[model samples]
Target: MAGNTDPLSPRAKLAVTAGRAAAAASRAVGRGSGSVIGGKVALRLDPDLLARLATHLDVVLVSATNGKTTTTRLIAEALRASGPVVSNALGANMPAGITSALAGGSDAKYGVIEVDEKYLSTVARDVTPKAIALLNLSRDQLDRAAETRMLAEKWREGLAGSKALVVANADDPLIVWAASSSANVVWVAAGQEWKDDAWSCPSCGGVMQRPGDDWFCGECGFRRPTPSWALSGDHVLDPHGSAWPIKLQLPGRANKANATTSAAVAAAFGVPPQIALERMYSVQAVAGRYDVVSFMQRELRLLLAKNPAGWLETFSLIDPPPTPVILSVNARGADGTDTSWLWDVDYTRLAGHPIFVIGDRKLDLAVRLEVAGLDFQVCEDVDEAVRQAPPGRIEVIANYTAFQDLRRRVGN
Candidate 1:
């Protein structure tokens, strides 16, 4: 009797329970094994499940500190020029989230996944993608990612035995170093045309200098070689200072990196460079990243700020001051549990003072501004902040969770 009623039975009750749960989850995800809601549910159940699914499909994995979502989406769109594709439209980068994305599109011929830095190595091992694109690595989410070196090491470990074609950013030292270690690699660089900041060498802790737009280590002599695929041309018009004329719908230098990276990945896959550029020009705003919207007779630029690197890049793109800035901070599970990252952003660069601060953590942002010796108006309600802000050129910066909330508040 005791054996018959065992809750931890080897194959009977446990198998039944597991089967039922899976079936319910499948049903919840909807037909064809795909649904945003369903994918999210699957992730909640198991994080490594996506890697298991990758073995059955053609996968293309993209990882980076910034621009992973836009770059992943752009890659998917470029591939779509040839055939059907599947991807996580919401920028879910974890193992389980990737599985959720796959489960949603069981019929797709190709899979495009944006992998989080922390999980890239694990996912790469499990998925064994056909090709992997390593975009630039920047300092972001210090609480979760700790340091960029840690992420670089993990990527090296995960991609050790991968036979997949490697697409690397020649402009970035970390990417150049990673590609050097790989056997099958195609290097892509943004050319010496644009001016941007490059990080220090990961090996000797020396400054990695850029001879052109391409980088080299001053002390270690670990410079990146010339890229096989390069974005060349003089005075390549960056209309919005975000790398333009290639047809970028977003604003900021980060967006340009995303576009260039997408073009490189597409070219590696044999997509014509001209065709890729055409598609890039045809694309529109991607919701949160530098998306412009109309609100209350004012033009609102909604930019997502998830970490220090992203915020710094966004701030750098802002046109010279006099443009009012409205920043919103929230404690959404997605923006991370810690709100201390706000202190890392250089708020003084806004030209003058922040016109308004909103969201649940208004005071928190206000305190940060004060510590920086910058003046700001704090509003407990997002709507009040939007209502009170002067109508004209305005910049609205928000985290992942607060983007939509502020969007709705501003009637975007």
Candidate 2:
């Protein structure tokens, strides 16, 4: 049996076959990566395809404004303790991407899905995930996504009907509100380093109280649930109050939080804590989030900064000794067409650091850097910019498309 369920229905097999043919044709023509379009066709042919394919899989669906890609990667690795897993590892979190992942394989007993914040409810409803992980929600793709709380409300409404166990970040008040009524929950105090969007109660519209690890709303009685797994310093503590240090190859406290959250989801699936932690320790990068790529003999660490909150956390990942850093921005639809969010970031933190701005919106970044009193040179090309920087360990941070383009330039 594949994935603990019966074989795909005749309808599902036909849809998957057509989708695969379409994907192969698209790739043959040298079009863009055909992962999405293939799934789109398959889903169009079989409206109930995701549900049908996920029939017997122990599915874990992860959703968040940021870190969903990396977190999903981590969870997939951890589920290796269970069996083979199917997942959308290329950062496509929509239905098509998810359908494509499942369509490729029949041997995978588990499906780890990274769902976009806006598409979480739709996918979760169809997949009927065994565990729904609610990571932090914040401002992202403002032009594409609804307001932060509105998205949370949609999650709350969707989850109310789902019988899946909820694995959630207890530190994010917005996340707490979204998962407060889940039928079964494993609350984790994964630590929210960015709290710009979580200031009020989703139920009563009353300002919430944040006095350290615990937060409670006086008006609506909304409060931070006691955590089952909590992050204390660099370690993740389990339900029995046993703590283990996560030795992840990926740097930064943000990744630490992500690993801890993934571990909690693993526990919900009965995975031993050590097995889950061990698998996560080996993940060096998730779709170039913490990849160290080479460009002219320099080990340039690539990190994604897709939004203001993400930028704030990404800045912390950089060493403070003042090494040369490349900043790239693109205003493509994938990277959020509205580049105005550049002003929303604290570019001032970049002051006194050697900054080389590149990408389609390099000039826009240069203007922001200038206003922040940060010295930066506009480099039209990332590789050329890397060549000009002084020889040392390098950190190159970029938004969505810019990160992808540079990864290709660096030979992937």
Candidate 3:
């Protein structure tokens, strides 16, 4: 049975009970999911509530600028093949939300947590995971988060001398440098399409030499490690030299990349790669991402792109031109108040599509599109934009807050 409180101390048990009540109240009022508020209330009542609950479960923390939630979901699903698993399937990666999730799934044998990149160290200290997935690090929420290189450095410092087995991306130079200090690491050659952030070496601030798939810094002589797992076009090659075709229901190379690391992480937990991959095939949509919602007599497939790197991957996933694309962006606290990252994304790729833009920062996106020699219509909202579109299925791509707005609107 889930939410069993017998293992917790009296103080922690009371905290968990109060947190559940608050969560129920929040959902009743429709303020939000109540995950974060509930956790905050519990933590305030008991500071060590997370650590107390985590002591009974084998935890795994997944952190990355993109694909954190999806990868966490895949890892959790894979672990479920062995026993019960609990996770923050929603995009609430902070401490409070994580606490609430752990409290709800008290009896789960495995705890798969999706942690925000900025809060990874703090959460890692409390959870003491059995394994940690270090995915690619790139620019995201520049106003709120630190630079990618600095984040990599922080990860290196945080994981130093830790006992957890690290499953990391070998293709990403930043990821490689970050996980270098861990005693045990399983490197996976998950492709990095966005390389603007890692051209310079994080080690000696020297220019990195990238001849082909290999990368190395000339000044400090830091080089790419040999990956035990590598991703070829449509298949993943394991440490044993055997290749398996990655047949996931999810779309794009990015999701395929995510699946590769997920399988490796599941292997750390004693689940076979084949079994993990089989479980991952069932996860079609993650927190409304890649979810195709029917709206106004047309199908709208939602995709999330929070940064330049994310936008690049999203371009490949969206349906080709002729089909309308609704791009919504918001400059709220969640989306990063500074909209300067807009200029970093290449809007030219979307030139052929009939684009409909909406959101708080629609004007900012429209300006960028215009400068890139593209035509777009700035609509009042998603409903207006969809009603004005031609027909058939359309793609709705948005940033963090804007994505949530559309997800709520369509009831995804």
Candidate 4:
């Protein structure tokens, strides 16, 4: 159905009403992110509310350790060409968030949902999505997500039961293993520069080789799948060698990878590359991921990276030493209580740079920088850090709540 505007069933209607009331209450009290807590209450009231509202809608679920939020935003924007597409704009990927978006947009027939890595299986099993995009697996929120390998195993279990078409990143061995059991798959070569996550094959402890840049495991013979879509330089290429050039407002290799994977998802749903690419270029930011905002009265580029894999990619975007950069971290519930993943990232590469460390976890990062030989000064306050950073092109990278808190502070 193009537009499913029919009224929700009585149970679902009641759940949605209660959820809206909860959201209103939260907003009234300024207790939390209204998008999250309200939907949680609704799901508690009616566990099956999401399945009911999503029954008649076309759903596309995007799950990844790094790019799912931006990717979902891109896909959701592309799907709007068809009609209204439902999605949570905030980086809310849990069941509550999914229900919140659905309850608010009951009339929308198309959905582009960003799912949390650990919760993807449960959500997919319930939604039976029309398409699934598995970007990459890496250590993220260790306290909350357990480990990446366990996440991969859960994905494998989920895929065995999923009937949806999977758009998987073939560059990462972990993603290949997770989607290997899928009935329908469209592989995309959206580059994975960080090989730390794929140290040994996810399926086998066998050492993997890049035969023609496609990973192949030596022991159990698990291998990289051929990509039907990929990014060749600046152009998005098809399997038959045709290419579509995309000009993005968002920068970085990570974002390009996100855009290419999103195009593959769009293509699986019958959207031509041209249409998807056009909409992708229009996306400037996802809840302030790549926003250029003034902090301490100076314009600075903002980036969010919550884990090692993300930090590695974002670090690559840094120009060089003496280019002012601020590293912010936090150990909030949203950011996971464990800040140990900081040790996993190769901050040694940060040596020879002018760095200003900021956040509640700023001391922890400063210690790591001292060990890595990166000369950095610690400024616990966000505004103070901004005031002290070298006067020039400034870049700020913050994790989870640390980033949100800054966005809120500088928000006008």
Judged by lDDT, which candidate is best? 3
Residue by residue across 1-412, what tens digits does model 1's lDDT show? 1112222223332333343466467667643233334445554555445554555567889988777888888888887776678898677677645766765554566789998878777777887888898887766654566466766766776667779888887777666666666778877664322223346787677876765455667897887776666554421222123332466666655666666767767766677655666776655766455667777667888888777767777787765666778888787666666778787777777757346888777788889888888768888776677678765677888877788787666655
Candidate 2, residues 183-210: lDDT per residue as tens digits?
Answer: 7888998888777688888778898888
lDDT of 2 at 403: 90
lDDT of 4 by residue, 144-169 (tens): 87578778888988898578999999
Q: Tell me which of candidates 2 and 3 scores higher on TM-score.
A: 3
Global fold similarity of model 1 (TM-score)? 0.80
Lowest lDDT block of 10, candidate 2? 1-10
What root-mean-square deviation over C-alphas does model 4 reach?
1.6
Candidate 4: residue pairs that collide: none
Query: Scored by CA lDDT, what does every candidate get?
Result: 0.68, 0.86, 0.92, 0.85
- Best-fitting candidate, scored by TM-score: 3
The 10 consecutive residues of candidate 3 with the worst lDDT sum are: 1-10
Give per-residue CA lDDT, model 3, range 16-89, as digits (tens): 98998898899999989999999999999999999988887899999999999999999999999988998999
TM-scores, all models, native as reference:
0.80, 0.96, 0.98, 0.96
Model 3, total clashes: 0
